[model samples]
Target: MTPEGTGRALVVGGGYAGLVTARVLADRFDEVTVLEQDHVTAAPEHRRGTPQSRHPHALLARGADLLEGLFPGLRAELREAGAPVSDFGQFPMLYPAGWSPRVRTGLALQTFSRPLLEAAIRRRVLAHPRVRLLDRTRAERVVLNDARDRVIGVRTTGDALRPADLVVVTTGRNSRLPAGLSTAGLPAPDVLRVDGKLSYTSRVYRRDTASPPDWQASLQATLAPTARRGGTVVALEDDRWLVCLFGADGQSAPTDPAGFAAYADSLANPHIKDVVTRAEPLGSIYRYGGLGGQWRRYDRIRPWPGGLAVLGDALCVLNPLYGHGMTVAVQQAVLLARELDAHGPADACARFQRRSARTLLLPWYLSTSLDLGWRPEGASVQALLARRYLARLLRRIPDDPELYRRFLAVQHMTASPLTLLVPSARGPSARARRGGERS
Candidate 1:
């Protein structure tokens, strides 16, 4: 195997994960080629490749910071494109209990449609002299050496073989890499899945800048069981509001105009309903369903091949309800860069896969533990307890500003989860204990 920074690199899938991965590889590889199945355009529009791009997306604080580092001045660019930035606390969120207190937490949140962000990142990544993008090119499978110990390159759908020293797969949730691996006589990774039977119905509306709403963005978070219906209203570029109403456990929102408005009215919070009633619809409503959390244990495979690494949703896919998918993908790309620097190209593939699994533990736990609540029969005792604790924490967030701030910090992956475990002096539990002492 060649040393790091001295070989050719190939990335399959030129979406968000693939684009970011290519940018990172350009720093170390002599050339980075990205194979995209869709005919990617320079403009910001939804493509057939990513059906979910029509929905709302959150670039959390940590992800924003990492992306800005990777593509310098990206935040400014997005802002210039009219994407609004707000503090975490300023965003109004209606939890299961009630409306969370709005206070300045300093953690930043930038809201935009998925297509806009992807297009912006794609432009920057393609501008790198070492990176090359091939639109409408589909990768069929990885080519291995005679010993089947290392990946030599990838075979395209057109029966063409492209040689590379390293091949990274970022093919998102519906990846075909496993079938190809099995064909090569390699063990497929074990899969763990927890389905909440969630679905999202989204639509874009013209925001009236002349008569702006009280809040820039708002969320009615889904609480399992009784409160399966939820919604969110986020301000996007071009004076548009991206509204998404989601339901869990087969309570999907309707796509028809009248029915869609009715579903919005039925949500626990009225913010989404207000938007639908006031704003003018931009286009047809779109629905994407059958969502679930899936984790492919690629790191657990023994005798893993060299010159191969799986990333993003290809490795682990979280339910989009939590808005962690994009952030986690970006974080994995950052980890890939670090691993390449530490282990070099010859040995980094396997090590990066293992470390990426570790990095996914927190986001996986957060998404699945809450999702398991929809089907209590499938939840273990530990998952049930964690859900109960989180439910209680949500109730406290309305009254305790500090606790709410910490909760947002953890949710955005900016702070450690341990921060949520520490009790605030102003918290109800602490106050109850102090009352007993005073008595």
Candidate 2:
């Protein structure tokens, strides 16, 4: 098939990553088509395409900023829809040591269910004049040129072909891109995986606005080696609270009502349990497992084809426990946009792939290091040392507000992790030294 200049772009999934990609491609391509297998709906409801959507999700400070920049007034629209936007620093947290101090740190976190956020982005992206959504259509494999040096388009189910100048795959964690590449006579990217055997059981509860909790959201993080249980209670739209209880290693949360409540009560902190005990259940408990980190080293592939790029979970899937998946996906989308704008479609795919791999390094390290702690066999020397340092830092956070603030900044991706290496101004020794110097 012959192609026009800067012609069509195909996105082989309509999830969050795919939507963002379609939006970005719309700016450069004459036509952008998103082929999704699920029958997407207008309402903020869960679909079969994303089973994890039923669980609680967090949009980190960095992700919120990027999404707002991409879709102006998105935060306001979510706020109007009753999604709570609050300073992330003020959210109460129970760490390995004790309760984290609630202080303002200028970091904003917008809380909502995954489905709601996806629906919001989907509406905005599909509304673009250049973007089109082809729901209930599955992209069987990417069509390649005879030379196998370039991707020509995608072959959908029923042997139908959709021609495009570029084909971006965002099929997510369970992507079939590897198989598709193999079928197209190309080498599949090597997979790197670290499984922590993490599991989540979540349920929504009716929030009583008249007697609101002191904190809008709360977290009790799991500390490996001793504590395998953790949970979170975040305020969501329509006066609802999404409570998710999780366990690491061999532990798994029960889906039964009584068992779920018992799991929450077993946590080291009482915050989530207290809320779960009193709140009225709004829905059935949903459970998700097989959670861990996986990375497809697409950048390392030799003879990488032009006009093909993998973004988001298709390239790397970080354990959701750290809440880095959405943020990293947004970062990848931003990187893709920059590459296309700088180099144009003809030569941007390979460069974008390599850069995207570099972008995943930090988040992959942060996620796997903690997960490795759950399985001693998989823990390398570097992972062990990181866990030790993180444990010490968590122990100090409760007593040092400045330290907690800095940690919060790092968690939100607003500050560098190196900042944590500095001594806290509020630490007792630091204060004493400062006093002596002043005297």
Candidate 3:
């Protein structure tokens, strides 16, 4: 059925990015629909779509702000649902620069599991008037038009063609978009990975203590210096807690509970193990690996499909270690809205792709730069320099409060990447900047 006005806009993938993008489309198009292969559930539970959802996830202050703007009262609703609020100041955080001195200042990092967060956002998106959510619906293929430059719609298993004015793919990292769309005579994007042979394993535990999980913040880990690692605690509803421990390439988190505990103990700090040992066990350990950074330049080709664009993991998959994947998705949605507001549908897809790439380039480079640091086996010259610079900055961070605060601000996406290179604490000053920091 043709949607009135400009026709229906369909977003494939029900992850954070897909949901946000679909809402943005609803504003520009007559109607918007979101498609997901896995069954979407209202209650917080693990699902097949996001195997990584089992891990603890945090909504950074930057991402939280974007999300709140997109869907009002979201944060409050989450809090009411038992998602704990963290000031980041009080939250123990051991940056590579040593302990961040648990001061009562810093951006807010809301704590919760991926499933819980997704479920919450899904509910909010479903409430939108112009949005239709179709769960357990797999997008079989991209229905290409005569010119093959733009995808007109998606082919569903129902042997039906669900045509639309625009299609946004958010199928995520395991996406087969490249191969699926290659039949149209366009070559796929070249794969670039920093797979330090990394694998991830996570589990949730019931805690008897009233205080929230703290071990995640106390570890001093960075991508460049050594084989990197991390852990986090997300206070869930009902006084429960979700704990996730990650080890960098080759330093995989074990699948067995006992082995996982051992890996945590071996981290720079023993706090993670201490918390795990004390917290009551909730579920068996769930392990997921093959986590790598990937980017698909669907818009890079000479002619991208006019009515189709990809979002989220379908476009750029970041190293989850940076915790910016979800944030990127939300930001991309916001970008899509801006582009549509400025241009007509005929040229919007191409513009959206370029804009989408711009949104991801810096963060993607930043994330991979660090990933290169962790894997000594494949260290690049540039990666080494970044590693050195980051290491040096961390060593001086604790002693230099201004420096430390500025770094945290940028790391939290509160400030621009240029903040590190500025000479004037405020801006360009009489003195030139050094390494993007105030000289």
Candidate 4:
């Protein structure tokens, strides 16, 4: 298990984080093996591997930049392949702010389905000489050293335990790390869960008519019962629009054309409904429920295991509507690469978890804060106040374009949420500053 001289590193997933970490590892380590349960194919179609692949997804500005840095020319290739590359105003947009005014705000967004992005990343990963892709392999246990604490390899569910210098579990949202560890008779890691009883049904539409005006490149409409619904008409390489609609359980979206349209018309804004009526049907509506929040606290453990680490949704998962899952996963992977390189000659697993825990702070807060807005029975006074305050700001977005841009930037993960409160365009007014108090 010596890593001093080009040791093997086993990465236990091929999702966004796993793939990036594999590529980064190949550059420094002698060998990098990525074991995935499903075969990695180039098709843009969704498969059993990722149920949510059919849903709408985007590469935020920060994530996009990171990918571009790792795999240069990736953007040009996607754009040439038919993926839309442009600013917020180019696509139809909507918000509680009304149909967002069609104005150039300089904020850029990369639109595509999840599978398309995965395909691109997979290609890059497979191209690396030191990287190998192993499909249909299921991880069973971590190979422990004489100390019974330091992991040295991974044994597949039905396969033999093989030695390695490192093992990263990137199993994603349905991660079994805790159960897996407990089954192996190890101490369980700390865990966190936050549920926002929200739900939705999604259907794809091949837009035939011109897009709606002031159409947000995407839309998250305010809905009845204080619920919300959102969708994005992304331009896939095949020239089809992947439309997704989400809502709280009581006001959940439906798959049937009639029911779906009715729900769209019910939105605070009308642009999404307008597009729904005219867009050509591409496929049947795909529905998924049980929307919630989660986080695994590995760093808090007093004695973290050696030779083992976690990444991707296995470590932290955010609400899908926020679209920060992939972005945060990418950021964490980037940090993994940085930490591993610095501590390559020493014990790095514990350090990796600490840094990863720190990185998840901002995204975890954003997702948890937003999810608390709607509840199954009733919301608390704090939730009500927070909702009212946010709603007021959202309602004012139409009149204040600067505020709109700032909101988009923060939502896109290009800027920190705190940036909006500081002294800047559309920030707290001088009056509030002079008062020496909160806004």
Candidate 5:
């Protein structure tokens, strides 16, 4: 196959990651097909495959920027669709140390449910001339060449075979790619698991009109290891708020209404309880319990098969509290585009995986460090010390707006984690200096 638009590309799954991957592949492939197991909705409705779509989801500033770049006027379209946009730093936030002062950092976060965002992206991607979405179709295995050295296509159920020059896997956390590789007589990537044992219950509520006019949302983060419970109430498109109450270890927010309220009341901050007490319920409480960080060592898998690549949760699943999953997926999609631009489809798999490892390292470290607190056997001194330093930084955020800005930048995936570890022109305090030494 040639480097430019003359070959077929098959993307497994049609979630946010797969949809974006298809959009990226469409620029280089003559034909691109997205095989999704679940029936995708035309509108933003919950599907059986994605129960977590009912929970609160926010697209970080960086992710929003990339999406807009990929699909022109997307931000404007989302705004027209009633998704509210707020400055990242101006939200009503309650960190471990009191409230964060509102500061206009110029970074904007568009708040909405995952289903709406995925649906919007799906609509846009499936509209392309070269792109086709095969919903309710399962990609069972990868078809390899005679030597078993190159993936030539994918096999679906019903004995259907779709030939492709490149195959991108974005089947999400529960992906069976390892088994598929093993079944193809290939070396399946080794797996690494970090169980946070995190659980949460989420529900939608009608936004209260009586609230302060400037109040857009409230984010109260839990200080892990010390306080295991936290929650957030975010404004959605339809004058509704998505409230999610979370706990680490074995403490799960109950699905029952009364117990849910009690969990909210137990949070260190009052905003969660306030929303639960004042807002009218719009939906039943839904709970999701499987929250863990898992990474497949595809980069470490030497002699990686040609024409095969992995992205999104299939590559690494992070704890959702950091909200890095979608953003990381977007970053990986961009990386895939860059790799394809430089190397084409045949040799892009290993190069893309190697380069994307840099993209996954920081967020993986951040989420796992906090999550390891729940599992003593997996916890390390380095992780504990990193958590302590972060806790101190959070405590100082109310006093230092610049620090909060830097932290926000890192949180949004715009800046490196070193921005938090190293101080700026303001110079480092005794504590920050010590934190740097520790880091």
Candidate 6:
């Protein structure tokens, strides 16, 4: 059936990215339908399609801001639902530069399980009159026109044909968009991958102590080359802590309780070890691995289908350690809405894809650069130099609160990456700046 004013827009996948896409589409299109392979649950539990949701997920400051803009009262609603709020500086983060300088940076971080966040967004999107969420319905391929120049709709697993004027694929890392394009007699996009061999083991614990800890959250990232183990302890709703132990380059976090604790103990930060051993256990350890960063260069496809666009992981799957994946997806959704409004439907798909490539460049570079360091075969010279520079910057963060705040700004997606490269207290003197000369 043709929609009210604009034609129907079909979204493949019902994850956070897909939900956000659908939510945006509802404003531009007459109707938006979301197709998911697994059942979408209202409970704060992982769906079959989202195994990694079991781990602690960080919603960056920019992500929270954009989400609140899209869904008003979202921050208050989430807080009411038990998602805790904390300032970014409240977290005692141990980077290669020792512990992060704890100071109120004024940036807020919304900490919660992935399932809760996804469910919340799903409810809002599905509640829209123009949006219909079809869970347990898997999209098999994108149907193309007779000339194979544009997408007409999608073909589902149940022999169902969903015809639409626009199609956005947010199916994520396991997306079959490339295969579907190939099946439709189109050239598949090239894939760029960095195999970090990353693995993580997570478990929930009950924080029953009457006295609260000094820190709200703790993150310890393994320094490359010398260290390959890291861990994070994030406070969750209902007085719980979600602790994750991770490793890269063959140092895998074990699923066994004893092994998990041992791995946490190996981390440079003693806080992670203390929380893991002291907190009362709530759930069995869940092991997740084989998460290598991969990006489909769909933007490079010449004569791209006019009505087809890919978002989120389907386009660029970053290493989750950076905690920017969700933020990037929401940003893309906002970009899509703006592109559609400005360009209209005629060229929105192609324009959005091209613009998305630009949007992901910084986050992609930042994430992959770190993942490149996990290579036992040694990183590229450029990556090595970049890492060294970052290490130097990290060393001075403790002594300089302003520098830490700036760095946190970038990490939280509120500042540009160039901010971190600026001269810190250890750099040139005030006199040197006046003379425009190097130290």
Best by TM-score: 1
Provide C-alpha RMSD values for all models, in order.
4.6, 4.8, 5.7, 5.8, 4.6, 5.6
CA lDDT, every model vs. true structure:
0.86, 0.85, 0.71, 0.70, 0.82, 0.82
lDDT of 1 by residue, 1-439 (tens): 2334678999999999999999999888989999999998899988898998998888778888889999999999999999988787878777766677767888887888888899999999999888999989999999888888899999998889999988999998999999999999999889999998999999999999997766779888887767788989999999999999998889999999999999998875666888898789999999998689999999998778888999998899899888788888889898988888887766888999998988788788888888888887967898889888887787788668789889888888888989998888663433332211211
Over 4 Å off in model 3, which ranges?
Answer: 1-5, 95-97, 104-106, 209-222, 375-382, 422-439
Q: What is the lDDT of candidate 3?
A: 0.71
State residue 7's C-alpha deviation in candidate 2, in Å: 0.8
Candidate 3 per-residue lDDT, tens place, 102-203, comes to 344558766766776778888877887889888889888888888787678888778779988778888888887788778667778766676644566777
Error of 3 at 11 (Å): 0.7
Query: TM-score, each model?
Result: 0.95, 0.94, 0.89, 0.87, 0.93, 0.93
Q: How many residue pairs collide in each prediction?
A: 0, 0, 8, 6, 0, 0
Which ranges in model 2 have alpha carbons more than 4 Å from their true place? 1-5, 428-439
Segments in model 5 whose C-alpha atoms lie over 4 Å from true places: 1-4, 209-213, 376-381, 424-439
TM-score of 1: 0.95
**Model number with the top lDDT:** 1
Per residue, candidate 5 scores C-alpha lDDT tens digits across 209-260 of 5654465677667666666778888888878888999877767899999999
Off by over 4 Å in 1: 1-4, 427-439
What TM-score does candidate 2 get on C-alpha atoms?
A: 0.94
- Candidate 2: residue 170 Cα off by (Å): 1.0
Ranking of models by lDDT: 1, 2, 5, 6, 3, 4
Residue 93 in model 6: shift from native, Å?
Answer: 1.0
Error of 6 at 317 (Å): 1.0
Q: Write the per-residue lDDT of candidate 2 for residues 86-190, one digit (tens) a residue.
A: 888778777766677667889887888888888999999989888999999999989889999998989998999899888999998999989989998999999
